[model samples]
Target: MSLYETVREELLRRVRNGTYACDTLLPSVATLSEEFGVSPITVKRALRDLRAAGVLVTIRGKGAYVKKQVRILRQLDMRMHSLHGTDISLISVTREKISDPSMVSLAPPDQMMLCVRKVISSDGAPFLYDASYLSSNVEDEIVDEFGRNFIVDALRKREIRIVKTEIVVEAFPATGKAAEIFDVPNGFPMLRRNYKMVTTDANITIYGVVQAPFDRLACSIDFPTLAMEI
Candidate 1:
């Protein structure tokens, strides 16, 4: 393997084995270079690559640190008719909650109440708390089909397709149960996501809330901005 790859793999192994826990600062570039018997540039490159891959994060003027564990973000492309175009959908749900349940009132509720909560971990370290709620009126069987797999996969089996979604992201101080689930001190910042999924025919809505360590979640949007005439 390439030198950078070798270093990255070792780093990742350390992360997985708890040598470097979440949000833990890493050694200096020079220190790593000396220990790994490589030039500082090689270590820098490896660190850069890992940061870009979401395995590490560099805070300006603060140095590099381990990023919180993240799950594979299932891509929700707006242009795609369905996740796999087979009438199935896939959504991620975790077992974390916000400081306030009133935040859910931001949207109108629909029929049916299918909700699932799960705790997500990285290398066995708890990192994410997610809860997903779906309208219960669509079909009882459809709700029952939400098996142990991804929620979208279950929705697909019922012939319900997610044609569109709206996401709202905000940062807030952790409180009450939210703080405990995230394993953060009181007032520590956490990311709260309010997501809504819409189907093609049933006008159904699926809402979800995800609470996770601020360092663990990263979001990026790629859309062309309108250009103005000079």
Candidate 2:
């Protein structure tokens, strides 16, 4: 490894493993350089790279420090990966006319939809609190299989193909119902995904929100690529 990379890697290791506490100040560049037997300029370059990696921060007058980040954010992908093994506890299921401004596009105003609230947990700890408003055109039997079947899979069983998906991811403090479900303090940082699904026939069939406290899980996405034979 190059000199700067070697320095940055060891510093990264310390920051991650808590040798340097998160949000606490790190050793001065000059001090670290002497300890590592490198010039202060090399150590400064390492610190600069770490800051860009979101692992460290440097206050104007205060020395470098570990950034206090308790969450991991990944890309928001529309594709289904696999069936969830998390225990699904049905919270409530009811038929209601859609009123949410964001959901109105998917859930027709005059037509009623199946509004379902459920919690997904792994090993007894809640990770996702999901609420979905699905077109009542979808059968009742499929709705009944919710806890056991993935929503996308159930839709496929009915020959409904998801042709388009629009998703928005936001990070904010949890409050009220969301905070209660995740069992975290009110105003705790959380990751929320709001998405709408449109079927191949051009019917908007699903409007949903998936929420989880940051400490519970990491997020990621894999997008498909298209290429012509070269």
Candidate 3:
């Protein structure tokens, strides 16, 4: 790796591991340069990239420090149709069952269980990795027809409507297993989401974990609240 990238990785590692707690001022450029055996210019470049990515903030007189964590916003809205109202084709599902034996569970016969593993990419780069589970026993036919984009529309076609959803978020260190799938260095920090998708007849709990490079992930949420009376 290039010197700048090495420095960037080190900085991110320290932040994620709590070596440099959030909002804590990092060492001066001179100190980092000496520690990394790189010129101050290279260290500055690395810091610049981190700042641009919203991972770090630089004070005019006090050196740079890590930024506070950003909250991830989850929004659920109706999918729009085209003017012609043509529906998009379902994602092709594969007949092959989940190869990961660790995911299998022995639930009661009445409960439906499904596991989905998807590698999410952005602009051609593999940026996000997700593994989700649904309680509704998806038919083999449905699995064979829709792959990654299978849930929302397939439920509609099956006459099962989702009435509500509950979402929870947390932060955790990436385990070795997760690091392998995410293709990132071990011990990275990631955002974990647990979702309960409720329908008229059943409730399916889905676990969605998003793992990405620290510099590449940004979470934002916007909502309105009622005005308070004086």
Candidate 4:
């Protein structure tokens, strides 16, 4: 691994293990450089990367701090992976009118969709709430699989391939049902990911919205992989 990345991983490990307590300031760049036997520039780069990774929060004129509620973002590549971790709990599946603006393009405005609701949890505590709005035509194929795996797998079962995708991410305050599910107070910051996928079958499009409390979800990208492609 690169020197800065090695330092970043080590720092992340410390944060996870409580060596650096939540909301507590980390060692100064100079101190870390001296301890790790790396240059100050290298330490600075590591800190910057950690901040971007959502493991640390840096304040101007001060050093970085371990985020009070840190999220270990899952890494994803070109392939769509299981959104939340492996632990999943099926909530409910029902037919509902397509009303969310993010999903309007997936079906006709007047059409009803099969909504699959599920929660992603860790050790029985739920972190992510996923609502997949599928084209009503594939009810039997997807209903059984979405509870155990992502929608992509169900689509593959029907010989369907996703040819294109668009994702929009935004942060909003939790309210009502959202707050109750995440066990957070109303107005707590939350992350929302709106997904739209187009499959080889023109009539079929997959649209989903995944929501999680801000501290419970994050996303990360490996720069080396992208750099290699270029």
Candidate 5:
């Protein structure tokens, strides 16, 4: 690889891993040239590459600074937009009996369960993929008109208010299934969130997870705080 490509890869790694904090100026071209043992021209070219990638911003007389984190959700909150969207891309649906030991007790014995796996897209590009489970197979619910949040929608219909929620968010390389669904190369980095919904009666009403390509979603402030977006 060329010297600038080598430097760019390392710098990209630093920015991604938070070694170079967001909104902070990167090392000067002179300093980077010395560290990478390359000419200043090469370092400038590498920084320019990052700028084109939306990872860096160059200001006159101020060098380059990591771009401030931006929210990609626009006006819609994730929970509402992901489910109540007019632009959903359905992938597949499966119906099965409740078998998970922990979740079996959430509903009556022998309750038929439904699983909906879908993708959320923008400008024709898929960005989020999710697999949601519901306590019953409301076949008609698949219609966009009836399709709201599979979990919360069902609960709300019964006036079951979620009293408490438990959410776990983390980053992991995309699984084979997710990589294909997201149209990303294998093992691409992704953000995942697993959550449990509890009703006012203190019952765990639903459990499911959502995954999104890390690049499409700008993590909220505090770098890792982006994990809370789910």
Candidate 6:
């Protein structure tokens, strides 16, 4: 790696590892230059790249500080934008009977289903927790594959197609597992998105709940322009 790139990555590592907390000032360019054994110009270039990536902000005459987390979620596509520096980890995978009436569409209430939970983090801070219920088939294989990949991707590999999807958004307080994952107060506000995905068989095979700190996630919608009748 180039000198500036190396410097940038090390700085990012520090930020993610909490050496530099959110909204806290990072060491000055001279300090970083001396520590990294590079020139001030190299350090500046590194900091500039980090700032451009939305990871840090430079205040005139004040230096750069880690920015507060804000990940944009494109509601139409249901994907996060600008997630270049995030990590996904599987939390748990288990087989359980479908007790929720709404989930019976996936299978009979008495039948067992697969449950998978995962967490996504940025800057070493956990932001989103996702719990999904899926059809129970090849449960062992699903659990094994999920350790290194997402359940959705594993389902696709098995030729399971999501033909339709519906997402419902709401604000709820964090509690239980979500509260612990986010490390926030029990009553902290959260943005919850519940999704139901129907497969080719017209059965809802995937039902999931994704939650994040209310301020950490933003939703954007774009409308097409139309000519008005004169």
Q: TM-score: which candidate is best?
A: 4
All models: lDDT? 0.67, 0.74, 0.60, 0.79, 0.67, 0.74
Candidate 6: worst-modelled 10 consecutive residues by lDDT: 100-109
lDDT, model 1, position 44? 91
Return the lDDT, model 5, position 62: 82
lDDT per residue as tens, model 3, 23-53: 8999999999999999999999998878755
- Which runs of model 3 end up more than 4 angstroms from their true locations? 1-112, 203-213, 226-230
Candidate 4: where are CA atoms >4 Å away? 1-68, 76-85, 101-109, 221-230
The worst-scoring run of ten residues by lDDT in candidate 4 lies at 76-85
Q: Pick the candidate with the highest lDDT.
A: 4
Q: Write the per-residue lDDT of candidate 2 for residues 1-230, one digit (tens) a residue.
A: 99999999999989878899977999898799999999999999998787655577688788987876644344455333242445778999988876655444444456678888888776677778888887777666777876465677777777778888887777777778887786555667777777787887555467888888767656786646865466
TM-score, candidate 2, is 0.58
lDDT tens readout by residue for model 6, 1-230: 99999999999999999999999999999998999999999999998888655578688799998988766464556444345677888888878865644334444435677877889887787877887776676446667776556655766787777787877777777677777787655566788877778787444367777788776776665557975567
* TM-scores of the models, in the order given: 0.52, 0.58, 0.49, 0.61, 0.52, 0.58
Task: Kindly report which residue stretches of model 6 are placed more than 4 angstroms away from their true locations once superposed.
Answer: 1-71, 76-82, 98-111, 201-204, 223-230
Per-residue CA lDDT of model 5 for 1-230, tens digit only, reads 98889999999999999999999988899999999999999999998778756577788798999976543543222455453333666677667665544343334346566666777776666767766665564446443422344556655666668776666667777668888786555556677766666677443355656788677764342343455535
